[model samples]
Target chain A: MRDRLRNVLAGVLEVRPEEICADMSAEDVAGWDSLRQLEVMLALELEYGVRIPADAMLELQSVPAIEEFLTEHGAG
Target chain B: MSRLPTAEEIAGRRRQGLELTRVERPEATALHVLATFNLDLLPPFLTEAFDRVGRSVRPRAGAFGQLTQEILDPASRLYAEPPDEVLIVPAAEDLLEPLFSRPPSQLGPDEAEALVEERLAELRGLVETVLERLPAASCYVVALGATEGPHPHVLDPLAPERRQVELDRFMRGVRELRSLGPRTVVIDWDWHMRSFGWDAVRDERLWYLGRMRLNPTGCAALAELVARHAAAYRGQARKVLALDLDGTVWGGIVGEAGLGGIEVGEDGVGLAFQDFQRELVKLQETGVLLVVCSKNNPADALEVFERHAGMVLRREHLAAERINWQDKATNLRDLAVELNLGLDSFVFLDDNPIERTWISQACPEVLVPELPDDAAERPAFLRAASWFERIEATAADRGRSASYREQRERRQFERTSTSFEDFLSSLEQEAIIDPVHEGSLSRAAQLCQRTNQFNLTTRRHTVAELESMSSDPDHDLFTLTVRDRFGDNGITGIAILRYAGELAEIETLLMSCRILGRKLEDAFLAFLARRAADRGASVLEGTFVRTAKNAQVETFYPDHGFERAEDGVYRLTLTQGAVESPASIMVTVPANA
Candidate 1:
């Protein structure tokens, strides 16, 4: 699961997957924004073929939150 | 896939792409657009069209002896700096003489024919020159000439038979040259005729002088013609034709005409209705979708189309038909909903002054041709409309009319279904999406530039600008080409993903007008959401910059689940699990899009 998240973040954030971590937050990341957040969502869903509910979008606050949500939602 | 080609190669594929996106950039690349003119009968507005497209024109002196020499000799000294996108618009003062009773003898049969041949040869040479310089620059040749009029003196030497001979020969020459490799487009003016016989050229001075006397119908025709060619060359026609019935399709009202009294048949005023129907039917054949908004009993109108012998357009022909006795504005709104067409694609034609005025006031996006009060003038009136000016029509257009008809029938079947979701499920719409690659890049950039409504952050990019984005390591341009069970909608939507360090931004999001309302956009956003979440990116940011035509998408993010952030921005967090594309929407993202 951690490796999968890193691969997705690697492409979206234009960083090596090794550079991404579960502790990453908007303030900690240099380029994170609402726009990039959507890109991350799309890439992850496309990569995993998972369905993201519209209501759950509001609950996503940080990488840890995304990790927990993805695990719960069966997104790899 | 191999690394994307350099920006220069993408711009090299098509020149206009670069021009559109690089307009404000300080560094200007030179483009050579061949604008040929008769120099003998040029219109004052020809230059304006060229100017509108941002081309610097150098008028080549046509084959008029000293005039040609005069333009060529001092030309270098007259303006030292050669302009970018030099155009050669072939216009002449000769065409105007026919408008006047006094005809110029200089354009004798032999001279005119010889000049025609000479110009044909020149055009061929220009094509060769432009092709040789291709990759570095591109040129477009616009062919426009005068038509025969009523003035007999002018008509005497420039007889229709003789002019037809020259025109045929010139056209032959054009075909031969086109075979050799020129990207050529012809604007035929031979069809423009005065009401009177061919000798009407003799009456040019007495009747219509100074003005082209181009009526609404004629303007629409010319615009439609130009638009067709523009689409063919530029790659697609983004405009949609929205229509109205009742007084428009028939004389009197459908509510009042009582089906049989509509007056569309073999006799007197019936001929007017007949002619109008025939012309519109022909337009439908050219790939223009016919949509109807009528205030009538839906069953009665359907019966007319299904039962009437004189009815040329059946109910099956329309992309969308709104037949409720409600305000036309309301019907127009419903029609947009039914077809997923934007208001801008709609060109409404209504004969009734009141209804026409109402629609014009209520839905300003629709182009309503003002018909003359005399029903007798309807034929001439339609001849002058600009709704049909198109630069080119591909094979796809030929099937458009038929496809829309089939689409309507399918919708009707769905109407009886239990729920909208059930209807969507039954139709089997699917969307196939792929990363933006070389094959689809040209078309994708066009959607970004032309699509006006339903656009968020209406960022118009040129092929050049898009190419630059692809080259710059921080930016990613992804295009979505959509097709469904109905027909191929071509490359309809574009998403520009720009990144700064770890964060990504949607710099541009736009969809073609025809593909709206099907939840393809929701699917697109969902795709974006999932992609964003994967990158460990917490929030996906976007903006809705307003334009007069793009209010339809002002609250697009909110409806699609994004929350409004500070200033005009919207944000969505990726932890939002499993975003599903709108419920049971039938969209097919092309597997190879």
Candidate 2:
């Protein structure tokens, strides 16, 4: 689940999956701006078959937060 | 379903485009964006989309709030660097104010309707003001969405009484803009939001943060729509839709499975292919020439069309057909030569992945869209493609399939006849030289843009520009219509003459290559000479600018008694009595002439 989440975020950020970690946030990645945040959110939604609610999008700034949310939604 | 690229994907593509140092950008359509919201990302997205599809656009960033002032001011960047396509995306919040913010429960029905009318009138004026200033450039006015209204307005989209009124006003503005000219292409992204998701279109986080109206998904769709509009206006829209048979148009191969085995009827799995065929027929009616380039026995392919009880398309439905075994690439090239159309104008659709790859490598100019693996998905995927986008479907455009079919019949006659001149003479060809009318001006402009190989100057003009030229007193505009015994080719020639007293200069004169090799060119020149003499002009001067496609016409003037002057202009002294019309074609002149 972490590998998949990291890979999806990496694809959205145009970086290698190894470069993305659970603690990696917008502050760490150069391309991880608010726009990339939305991109990663949508990419994760498409990848995991889960629609992250608009309110939940704010918490998805970092990879760890997304992984936790996906688990709560019963997504891999 | 079409995948809407993530905004990150769009950004990455834009960065990739910036790295393309040697890639040639064809038809650099200068674009200006005037939005009520922040469109900081739209420019790159638009450019990237344009680059993807045969065009390259350079947007003059995007202006906010003071759109009217920026457009009209000569010293402003809008006028200083005037664009070819102006993309206007007015927000509902900016166009309609407090009334829009209020719920329908608060206002009476009459008040709501009245407010809608008042706001629409104001918007009409704003659009008109922009049009009047930038008369040359085309406008893609993005219709305002009513989704941004108050809680009830956003939540209760199905509340027809409230949302419908706002929508009606927005659509009314779009309708008025449509009436202005062919140049104004309306992008109905607002309507697309019904399926594109309101959440995606109106991302509240970005809207509040920086006035960014669309999310990444919405931005991708908008970029595609804008790029298609630009391509359509530039006259780069694909003309031919070449279809491959045997698991393509039908389910089974006609050569192997036989007619009964093919799944293309009204029932069950066959319904999908039938529905797909119906869409192709619809596209054919809208000026797209349909041809067959299948690798099968010609007899077997014809048998499928003839004997198949489920087949919707008949023999006459196609402009040309090459159902031979000799590879698809050669067949397409032969079709191009036969139809007198450029290979770039073709969009080949074949079900076989191997055949698609072959043509993609061989004929890179032809647009072959990625088809779904399943037959059922092919039709839906085909219909959604932007390759056949058109600003307006005129009568001439609709009659194109019939015209191409007629050309095929003419070719048949030409073969059977003894000689080329004999074939033309026996056909009873009539060339009518008449003043250009309102009905034929759109076709005239289309001919000006599309006709290249036999064209003298190879100049492209929009419908608006052609209308302006036709109305100009100095320019004597005449369009020639040719009709043989086979069929009417329908306004195949255009001659625009610029007269300065006795010395009349040929501003524009081009004929459709479809009507070439018919001696109509000779007749067109004769008509021009007569018109020049009628106006007491001594000489009819013509300028033959060299273009890659028009090299065949470089010696056109010298061959037609036009002596080259020192200024590089072709000069032909007018002699009313001596100017002889071709005996082969029966030339009809105006009664006064």
The number of the candidate with the highest TM-score is: 2
Highest lDDT: give the candidate number. Answer: 2
- What tens-digit string does per-residue lDDT give for candidate 2 at B351-378? 7889899999999989887778787787
TM-score of chain B of each: 0.60, 0.90
lDDT of 2 at B133: 71
For residue A67, give model 2's deviation from the true position in Å.
Answer: 18
True contacts kept of each: 0.00, 0.00
Q: For candidate 1, lDDT tens digit of each residue in A1-76?
A: 3787788776665566777877887677776665455446645665677766544444464789888888888777
Candidate 2 residues lying further than 4 Å off, grouped into runs, are A1-76, B16-29, B72-76, B104-106, B148-161, B412-426, B434-441, B500-502, B534-536, B583-593
RMSD of each: 25.9, 5.4
Computed on C-alphas against the true complex, the DockQ of each candidate is 0.00, 0.11
Candidate 1 docks with a DockQ of 0.00
